[model samples]
Target chain A: MAELSKTDQVEDLHLVNLTKRFGEVAAVDDLTLTIPAGSFFALLGASGCGKTTTLRMVAGLEDPTSGSIRIGDKDVTRLRAFKRPVNTVFQSYALFPHLDIFENVAFGLRRRGVKNIKPIVEAMLELVELGHLARRKPTQLSGGQQQRVAVARALINKPDVLLLDEPLGALDLKLRRQMQIELKRIQTEVGTTFVHVTHDQEEAMTMADTIAVMNAGRIEQMGSPAEIYELPRTVFVANFLGQSNLIEGRVSGAGEMLDVAAHERSFRLPRERSSATGASIILGVRPEKMTVLDAPDAARVPEGHNVLSGRVTDVSYTGVSTQYLVQASWGQELVVFEQNLIVGDRCEVGDEVVVHWSPRHSFGLDGNEDIHAGVDSAVLALESVDSAPAAGDGE
Target chain B: MAPVLPSAAVAPPSTVAQRRSRTGYVLLFPGMTWLAVFFAIPFVTLFVTSLQTPVPGKSGRYQLGLEFGNYATALAEYWPAFVRSFAYAGIATLLALIIGYPLAYFIAFRSGRWRGLMLVLVIAPSFASFLLRTYAWKTILADESPVTSFFNALHLLPDGRILNTSIAVIAGLTYNFLPFMVLPLYAALERIDPRLIEAANDLYASPVTAFRKITWPLSMPGVVAGTLLTFIPAAGDYINAELLGSTKDRMVGNAIQTNFIEFRDYPTASALSFALMAAILILVFTYIRRAGTEDLV
Candidate 1:
């Protein structure tokens, strides 16, 4: 009878203007985000950057100093953690050392004085692939096994949203990667919204449907992983998500098209607009965008388009690519990512090369577009997740 | 050139440690032997002595003869004392648990520095002498004291006296063992992870349910340790009974003490002591074993 109500559905969670302060410092400042039903979202930031704080606030383990939280339109800001329809898988797993896998998973169920624990606990263990280890105590378990048990325990309650606070933080690197894929797979399979917190950028980017990049207690930017990486909206976001080159320039002319200049050449804007003519501005270029324009095209690179002339100072060989550090006029070195093909002659230690990129690859260094769209809830963005092919995901 | 080169300073430490461990075991055996000889031997001897006959001419003396009849006689002679001791000890332990649990919990879970000061204060009365404190109760409860006048004015006590009663004996015993209860209980409840309480509360259980299911269960070891600490000594407390209780409230310990010292009845004393020890041991063992399953929150 109870199964008819929820219909195997997980509820969406929303944190509205969540601001938590510990004395003078605001751990999470005005964090407003909505997690869609059944999405895996990541709140990523460095230590003390408030990622964990936000997750705790959602779980009702920590009340925000000022904010409102909702689970499927039900206001639950003041609700106690046990009273909320959420559970957490702590970084340490925090599995009861005294309880076996079965008992640990059955904890929430038994506490509610719920009957029929055996079948429910068995199904939970089966879901996490831990049925074989149901009788083993937590102390006897490996870290990964403990993590699975923690997941089993939280999910057995059929919580609305599962908050995973660095659930993979205690694993070895090899285990971490393995769990990342496994976690993503599990999220998708279960269709339960998972709000994961971690300081590891690659982990967040690789797993989350949407990643919220936080800095200094405020969300810098949030978008789908691709949008965060390729279309970061702040200098912080750009720098935080992989690497990028920032160049100071001016919009010399404007129309249906616009022209901008960096150290050595004028380039076109990706989007034409009517604003700030002859005003000082900054330009952004990803490393892969700039390339070595060889003997012929190097001579006459055009304005508002592909063209850069800089001297390559250093080159290092990666397994599949060579990276060249190029010096420009502004006394700043521009990094260029060159394909290291076995058939092609890669640049040696030092060589003068014209690095060229089309305007589409260039963006303003000062990124503030859609900064007011309430930093897309990392949860909803996670709904559209497709991880960049990992070493074995392609297989 | 001022400092000489270190000449293999630690080269033989391993060998030295091995030799020391051998020597350590050799040295440890004697102390253990003495414990076996003195402590263990006497306990066994006393258990043997309990099987004896009462010397008919003496009022409270007996002689050893491996006679099982001494046990029956001892029980008959001191059954009331045995019951009274346990009853008083039970009440004292209950009082100690009720009073000390919160104090220990407050120290372990709530109050920070105050816990330390309170701990010192709890132990302070013990250091001065439990007998003196029992005597102080004598002054407070007697008809001659200011407390008597206060009680008389309040119409609380018709006789205006509380000393030499079962309640006074229990109070004395509780006071004597309060620190024992507080310390071990504090240690046990303190070991509980606070997060567990929060975790339980978060899982839709009320605060009371969380505490009962989680916090209380986890602190079982402490409960056993504290209860044992309080109950064992309170059961054996002869001084409190002698000082604060009349014949009606006298415990098994009083009977044993009177047989050994007042009547010079060594055999009867040993028999009474063994009986008290067996009963206390069983009580303690049962309380602890039951606590194990239920206390681990």
Candidate 2:
């Protein structure tokens, strides 16, 4: 670990008004971002979202069509990839097939003409916990092991920032989970800035301290994982991060709390949570945030909670929870996830029910945007419902 | 109630395994039989003929007797031809590699949409007969041809002539076998993952270093295959020398052909062929061993 700390001062990566165009299509539009030093940051998006394009610009692999990039005080906009103090863990791991693990890890050090390479290489192999397999070629190692070698190779250079482009995209689900924690632990131990690019929301939430949600070559939102998840600013972020029940409404009152009316039902939205200034708005609530109770037990609902009466149209029993699709009186179906704590008094399909949640859990967005802007049609087709948990519960 | 079949009616697993192995051998019958009949029999006959002695006072006739002295006499009398053949072939192989590697690399990496057209061009010369192509070169390098006059003006040719020399023969050999070198080199260079080069560059390697470290090592299989394909055929070839070189520039193949066809010395011809085959085999074995492409070969 001591040998790995070659950089004394961590430098923030600054990408200012960066743009890249392939023919007529702008792969990365005019975008500006500042990733803080020594933070585990993630660029979360679906395929073709330009997350990888942004990372390649930072790594100096793709020249920006315009604008400049900087590391702290020095501008690196025109610097060649080899001249820049940046390295990337490519999506395919891209380990040299001819070089064994030891040589692969030693490549950077040797290229820089470091005299004492053997010890440094040995130390790097040990850092990745791959010392025993130093003599083995890349093809001989498993997927996860090759991933660690890729990390070790990039990290040994002591780069100012480490760019990972879908580093865990090739692994199985179980191995991906294991490597997620492993990568987080390594980032913590080395204290190097990690900018991970991935399409998996859960992976971003699990490993990254800050998550930037990207869509169609633009940044929709950037914040801590929890902040972005709980208070998404755009419709794309809300749907892409996880499932959100968006209800179209009109603002009836404005105050510390905004009263929104939707289909003859009034719901309270905290004024701080609403980003829309117009009378028309879209109120969003996560499926797991709302509770579904039978009509007879409606009295037990919290007093100050926003309530909507509906009929349970579909019921799905997952291992940890039961998902109920309740069709509101307005004919819009809302999803509610209830923990399976009580087995005997469960509401069945076709039962009259009331879905309610606190005002704090509701978010407001502009009604001008498309309601299905970020909903993946393929996933929606598979579920036959508007909002089901896109992935496993992160809480 | 259905009746159960007896256990004796079932085939044993070991018998089934044996039948599967038998099928494998049966599948190999045609290829093995063809090699044994055409290749193995001729090779054995050639080796036996190399050791036969000439019949007393009989022209172009041999007796079935052990005459190991034939090998000694062949090596002593025609050692210069053996040396010249190897030297010319070695130079031609080296020249082909130097000329073909860059063409292959460009087609593999930088040609982009024109890759298909370029590869077709590399193989297009092979569509014409090799002998015709060599004859075309003879015309191109004739004493009064434009190419020879151009080189003469540059004073690059000290002898003031391009035809009937070692250079002409070597150039012919290199030109005839260039596609062999280019195709294999292109295949190997094309198979390399571009990301490996990018990774090297990302790790602070300059483009030259990346090629030296990543590109070169990965293309070893192609280089080994290309050199072998070029060198082996060029070594035993007599057509280029016979067409483009003088009497003093003749190779072992010419000597063997002359001994058999003109002088009707069957024993000496067989001995010379055997000696050349053994020499090429040793050179190739040593080359493969040194190149360290054991797994590839």
Residues A1-395, model 2: lDDT tens digits: 56876467889989899899999999888889999999999998877889998999888888999988999999999999999999999988999988889999999999999898888888888877899999998877888888999999999888999999988777766777888998998898778899999887888999999999988888999999999999989888888888899999998674799999888889999999998879889999999999998898999999899999999999999989999999998899998998888858789899999899999999999988888877893253223322332222121
Model 1 C-alpha lDDT per residue in residues A16-52, reported as the tens digit of each score: 8999999999999998888888888988876678988
Clashes of each: 13, 0
Restricting to chain A, the TM-score for each candidate equals 0.86, 0.94
DockQ, Cα level, model 1: 0.41
Off by over 4 Å in 2: A252-254, A296-301, A341-343, A377-395, B1-13, B295-297
Look at candidate 1 and tell me the lDDT of residue B6: 77
| CAPRI docking class of candidate 1 | acceptable
Enumerate the candidates' DockQ scores in order.
0.41, 0.60
